[model samples]
Target chain A: MSPTPRRISTSTAVLPADGRRQNLSLVLQTLRRLGPTSRAQLAREVGVTKVTMSDLVAELIGEGRVRDVGTAEQAGPGKPATLVDLDRSGLLTLAVDLSVPARLQAAVVDVTGTVLHREERAAAVDAGQGRGLDPAVVVELVRSVLATAQHPVLGIGIGTPGLVAPDGTVRTAPNLGWTDVALRELVAEATGVPVLVTNDSDAATQAELSTSPASQDMVLVQVGRGVGCGVVSGGRLVRGAHHAAGEIGHVTVGTDGGETCSCGRAGCLETWLSVPRLRAALDAGDDPAAADSVAEVGGHRLAVALAPLVAALDLSEVVLAGPAALLEPVVPVVARSLADRLLPSLDTPLTVRLATSPEDIVLRGAAALVLWDRLGVV
Target chain B: MSPTPRRISTSTAVLPADGRRQNLSLVLQTLRRLGPTSRAQLAREVGVTKVTMSDLVAELIGEGRVRDVGTAEQAGPGKPATLVDLDRSGLLTLAVDLSVPARLQAAVVDVTGTVLHREERAAAVDAGQGRGLDPAVVVELVRSVLATAQHPVLGIGIGTPGLVAPDGTVRTAPNLGWTDVALRELVAEATGVPVLVTNDSDAATQAELSTSPASQDMVLVQVGRGVGCGVVSGGRLVRGAHHAAGEIGHVTVGTDGGETCSCGRAGCLETWLSVPRLRAALDAGDDPAAADSVAEVGGHRLAVALAPLVAALDLSEVVLAGPAALLEPVVPVVARSLADRLLPSLDTPLTVRLATSPEDIVLRGAAALVLWDRLGVV
Candidate 1:
């Protein structure tokens, strides 16, 4: 079902009518954060009366969202209280990503962001470029994953490389030759499941933001088929007015002529940092020094483009979400470039790190969208 | 007093315990947004019961935060309801700025963001480097402003440059030569008034975001003594992890060493776009063509740094907040530079506009900080 997308409020202030919903959300989030815990502990943590917490727990249990997982060992209390936690196996989320180069990946995940079953297939390549991939292929992948899901599926999420509308339409994806594709509606109609569509980088950002010890203000740059970015500040993804906020791949990096971009622009960051472009540049010459130099140049260019963002947003961390082989060398160069330009008085030094298996990050983020939208898990 | 800095929650969800408070905040915000209105209309607009709204109104009136402003004219056959609105004259806010070059400016403003009085004094400059201004002078300015306030002061807001801690400490302001100064505590001690402190650019961004039809995702670039940016996304200011978000001055724009910056870096955006630098470049050559060319180059350099941010954050607007003489010439140049690089498929055009009287914008924003913190007005 194509549920209407609701705009996320920037203000963190709670409302009167949302009191019960907020409390329920807090309980669920706490259960996810703290793992198995007692109702008394939850009541204390959530600032609710024990009786009220019991009621909330009962409602969650009835909905199959939480389960009573035995009792805590008594240390000093007369009676040990029953420990409850999220029912990880109780629900499933289907996530798919079309942003991966030459392949379409899908996964069945649980409410806790654990991938239960994963699948992928190579798309028929056209013209040596990532193009002419059929939208029906994505729809089929969602259906195939749904068939294997043993648990009740909460929703289906699709992350693609493009500007996505709130209503889940792909406004444009030059690499995939997709424009105004109603991929969300097609998948939902074929599988009869709730579907969410977002730009792949935004999905990856959401996944990163949901991780433990997550910084509320961070930037996740996914350097794969495209060199896009996702920004999270004040705990919300910055979906631009045109829903093209993370299209850093097309940002101009040089005035001199370079390789042409998919968006018809020359000298774009994508031209310099895209996996295919980097690979081609590496393949052009066999000398190790040349390769190292190329990697350094790529990293330096990326840093130059990103340093302004780091400063403008006061970002806590910059994550490179891509293959280690391609992004690892670039990390040191990028770090050095950033240090060279960034103000030296940085007390909490801006961290630059390589994300673990960012290929699946967008898929997980797609699942997170379902969790965030359907269950308010975030 | 320096209230402990409260961390902003990324989640927009409301809480159960905050029901009454949220309702009160909504009423106050609605009154401010919609102007004077009757309790029945407010109840209908806020989706609260008339009885509950009446109670809220009574509480607000009793607290002198709202006032009954006569009765609405009855169009239908019913008793005229009493109109109520925010008591604009009930509270005053004192705002100060250390971000201004060679001066400490302060203002006494009403709750409605109306400036009632203003004063400025040149700070003792050191070696014409825009440094050596003592934090004690800022404290004295706040005291002086507080002395002249005609109304009951809600709080004092100070907007300075460089990194600011949540506890109102100026971590480092190379321009002002401030380091770990407890300006908030000092002002509070000197005047016995509640105080809030923040980066001046952040304050300006807040003021801009509070304007009519404000875009939630916007950037305000203050091009003054030092070039810094203030970012607002999802309706909240993005104060980074180190409280140094929006420090864009040192972001390197070129390889050719121009002027060494106070931060000991060369080829910074500040070197290219700061008011003093541009003025010097203009005064160095009297040719109008050369001045236009210089302005264009400065704008292009700024756009190169900012385009990535625009693409990364999906910002809707980029505001140049500075003196018209310096910023006006750069506006069209910045717009052209951005237009040349930004993807052509953008549905919502990114706007570049000059801010109206940016010097006062920080002062207003400081007042806004007090409003946001003390009254939850934002």
Candidate 2:
């Protein structure tokens, strides 16, 4: 017997009850992307009635999320319309980044994504035993950032290295020696605010997505002490079925075996591409050929790892986030390798470039988590 | 200066104007999945009012897309309710499959996805010169299939081996010796039915998706004379920016180079995994070990090509569509290699299996394209 076709609905059906939230999110997102605009202009831009636009704007203003920023210059207009914009100084998000090995960084970010305050501390780690950062230390760092906030804090967002569940539990961060640490709960309790935790690479991806004009389908590779990636397809972050969508660090790359990884795998991507390994290779000697060879091998491995992704998703760009010196040399190698692997297409050539804001990417991405969670904006 | 966060709205905002089409599609999809359904039950399941559901159902019935079944078995009810379902016999779709080399296959499929009539003809090919099927032959076959239709045909859907543009242009089907051929226009002009052309691998994916209970995130690999993949992420088909998504046959897999492909690339996935090569290796000798080695090497290459995709997309399953003898042996090798490459996780193990309906997959998938395009039900 022929099997019946079980077609699943992929329609964009929205319930009437969710209309308000959807409209509100749309309005906020519009303002965030296009900057300040007149109420009438917003109604036209968002395709809502003038009355509905007025009500949404009023609600945002009353919530201290928006403010009337004087008036706009007339361009052959009847009157100068008062401009409404997000209140950048009224709300704040405390962001923590635990991606750096043996270090902790935090920042107070405003609504406009401006970092008002920043702090860093050396993390105490049992390096010999590979034990990760202490839970208390992470909580203290969040509190320390919270104490420096000058505005009403919306939430605390932490981007840590590990497999983070949607509920903010760190399933495992081998580099940090963490297993099932309730980082979000600890930070929220210690600081008395809502908290969101995500994989640092995903956070960085969000930050890159929010700050750059990249294509909706792109991957951000985070090369630090450990290697990971954040993937975005169709303008949405790809959190895998197991929340391990970008866990590429441990994927064995090539047939030829190389350095061993902490995961007990030889020829893993991390062994070839991690910042520590690249830096070690560079520091080995003044022999540029040796350093170049390391970069070449790492780049080739990275290309091997990324080729399938590029082919499968038809990715337009690959953004590498790390020290430019280490990654820049690797870019050409990756580009060449990808060209060799994928179909030769004159149009839609894949580009590999460094992240523009590499230094503060994770911190800003952590803030994006709070922004998206609390306000449904970004 | 820090850049402002440009948050694109990913909210499911439906314009009031689009409400009607969305609801109608929802109802049709519901019927297609659950068979016959009562009006009241459909309203409840779709979270819409009975009046709205009735109006949508009436429109579908008037269009001859749906029909009312006599009655449903009463379950703790005061009276039996009339059931509504898709009119399987009233409408038919003409599907064409030009994927098999030197063969042209066509089928007339009804709403229930049953093949009502089928026909096949040998394609005229300049084998020595590598010229593919003549366009006149394809058009003639479509005419023959349309003439046999017992009911009104919805459209013509084609699954061909090529890079198809959204406009139904066969941008390049090297197997068919077609370049920038306006296939949809040519077929529609001759048959007077709207035509949709898509890559055969993508078509097979649609057929598999519509027939099986596979995960939303999955990839279907088609192995015949060539290799290609169809990727589905988050329940939606991934059409790349250039409409070249899932064009993975040419991607080089391993470091060691092997036989050269027609694309002039050595060690392409097609060079290692195509059916002809596997068959040639199996026929090269009576030794089982040699055939096993061919399968092993092909399996390893496939694994290398897929590991990054698995890690990047966090796919839940990989479906192989081809002859059982050739593909079944390659499954375990791919699974074991993926396990070696990816992190070990007990929660979401990726499954690799053979497609259940390999013989009629492309033809059925072509019908699915018509279904999704015309009714927006899939």
Candidate 3:
């Protein structure tokens, strides 16, 4: 069965069609998080106004989406300032992460982005990643989890690997060996709940970004058995023309005519960076010095392959998603390479970070994606 | 002193407090473009109603901003269609390109985006990296052009290469050696006209995407001595958090130590791609056999840089910007690299196209940026 999920606050995602509802939701969510925020501060953060915030807060309280948390710390107060925040237990959401390579995770996500329940198990889809995995078994696994789920689930968010069209089609999923799958329909029809399907890496990136300081403009690189990236610009996920962006694994990095890549090419960066490929290269003992070469010259070749991206985009930070054991050994080489190549023009130093994602993060991300949609993009 | 500048279209950079006028303006502009067409087409394209389009068209014609262009082709012999388009000759806009690296350029743009009079001069801003080119000289140049112009200039648009904050302040310009310069004020003061400022590469990208067959998910890479890129995802520019997106020149390309970069670092792709740097590499007389190195490897490197961007975002194309003499040499390399790196899953091949840009694309880009604003972003 799947694990539990995390609490979600929606601000950067699309809002409800009616702007008044969007504004009202924003006020309630912000107040919930801030534990009793003033109307001015709420307006300032939400890019609205004190008058609007006040009106919205009143409406939300009337709707029970929010409540007065307490009185504010006043500066020689003429009146005891009223503090407001979301009713933490008022609404809870269920998030599902079928995106994991081999495991199913589920979580109970509250409106404040708190994770209430968590689970982990052998995911069915992962068996297909080149090792006789079946799609039907995966569907069954998701079913069992939802059947056992606690709390009144508002929605189900599924973050999986593949090409997800804006209209909710899984055009291609190599991991699952699937194509043009009617993902939303099947899941929505089965679960009898509103479902949202998004690219797995995109969801992880969203999770990382939603909780990070630099959510506005950042690129999140996921280095696992393969490498991919997600970009957040202007407080929104960068969904490309055909959903094919952030596929950095195919970048050619090797200077020599080297090994063949999974994409059927020779000497690609993926040949050097991905876990299985790197492990295999290490095992070959063929490039005898390849082991020592790990930190010496080609730990991942990621820095070199990624320098142009950072330079061209003027992005200040790069976040990573992967196992600590695999990612740790390579971070330094990449970091050193990056430090050497930054543009002289940028005043701020670029940073490379690791995503502190828990097992529940993917599921949380999925649920958060929907929640953000509810609150309206910040 | 200046040529009569053509108008890209009607637009306002400013987001108004009241949105009613914004919606009205959008309707007016749509009618102006599609011609005195039926209410149906405008309704679908503008996301308004047939009645709404009619009302807007009536208001625009009443204000003399629009006129009947001609009659539309009869569809199934329903009604003799009325064709309508903008009264193109009436609207006037000033387009300025302060970000022009080598020679300073300015012009008076009209509603037709025609340059009535043009003036040119030379100025270097960023110690020749083209980063910190002053926006003021462009303002004065606009003034000189406007002094003799006949049309009623409605608004001014200024495009430059740097990080432009939404408020019109250039936070940082590495090439132009500028930081925190308020460009709009200088332009307004010099030209005595309202102005809008934007990133130069972004403006160029906008011009490229606003036209025919443009993909929503595309990368516009402006190749010069210093390479810059613009990302369009879901039809919106991905301006990073600090608004610094599309600065690809600084990304690292060398897996190991190589040469120091212009950014006071080492092994940056910019060192290999920039005009002087590449020319120097080519002129070193290293080997005649490596004559095609730039052509073969440069494009490949670009493709690699784009791999992650494309795969992650599911983007469809990459746009190369530069005079053919410069960009043509790298096409094959890019194609080869991309071919090798593509994931086996994609059915449709990604496209890398040389920008079909105008002679003075930066100027047109500036004007086009204004046009988008005039049309109403939402």
- TM-scores of the models, in the given order? 0.92, 0.91, 0.82
Please give, for residues B1-378, the per-residue lDDT of candidate 3 as tens digits.
Answer: 011111111111111222335555566555545546665676677676677677767877786667777777777757775766666655667787766556767777655456777888677654565455555566667778888677666667778777887778788766667788988877777766667888888888877775533587778888765778888777777776456778776666644554776567665556566555446546778784464676565666667566655655667777887766656667666766666666643556777777876466777777766765654321
Clashing pairs in 1: A10-B234, A14-B14, B1-B194
Q: After superposition, how far is residue A226 of candidate 1 from its true place, in Å?
A: 1.9
Question: lDDT order of candidates, best first?
Answer: 2, 1, 3
Residue B3 of candidate 2: its Cα lDDT?
23
Model 2, span A1-378: residue lDDT tens: 012122223343445434566567777777888889998888888778888899989988998888999899988849988899888876689888898756688989986678899888887666458666788887777778788888878888889988888778899887688889988778777777888898999999999988985577899999988788998887778887678889888888877777888878888898888787789889999988988998998898999889888888888888999999899899899999988888876476888889978878898998987888777787
TM-score of chain B of each: 0.91, 0.94, 0.83
* Tens-digit per-residue lDDT, B246-314, candidate 2: 889988887777788888888888988989978988889999899899899889889988988888878
- Which residue runs of candidate 2 sit more than 4 Å off their true CA positions? A1-13, A48-56, A127-131, A189-192, B1-13, B49-59, B77-81, B127-132
Each prediction's interface RMSD? 10.2, 7.4, 14.2
For candidate 1, lDDT tens digit of each residue in A1-378? 012112223233344435666567778888888999999999988887899899989999999989989988997948897899998877689989888547789999987678889888777646346466788888777778888999879888888887888878888776677778988788878987788888888989888888734787778889877788898876678877677788888888755557777668787887777686667667888877777877888888888788888888888788898877877888888889888978754576778888755657888899887787777777
Which ten contiguous residues of candidate 2 chain B have the minimum total lDDT? B1-10
Per residue, candidate 1 scores C-alpha lDDT tens digits across B347-376 of 768889988555578888899888877766
User: Predictions ranked by DockQ, top down?
Assistant: 1, 2, 3
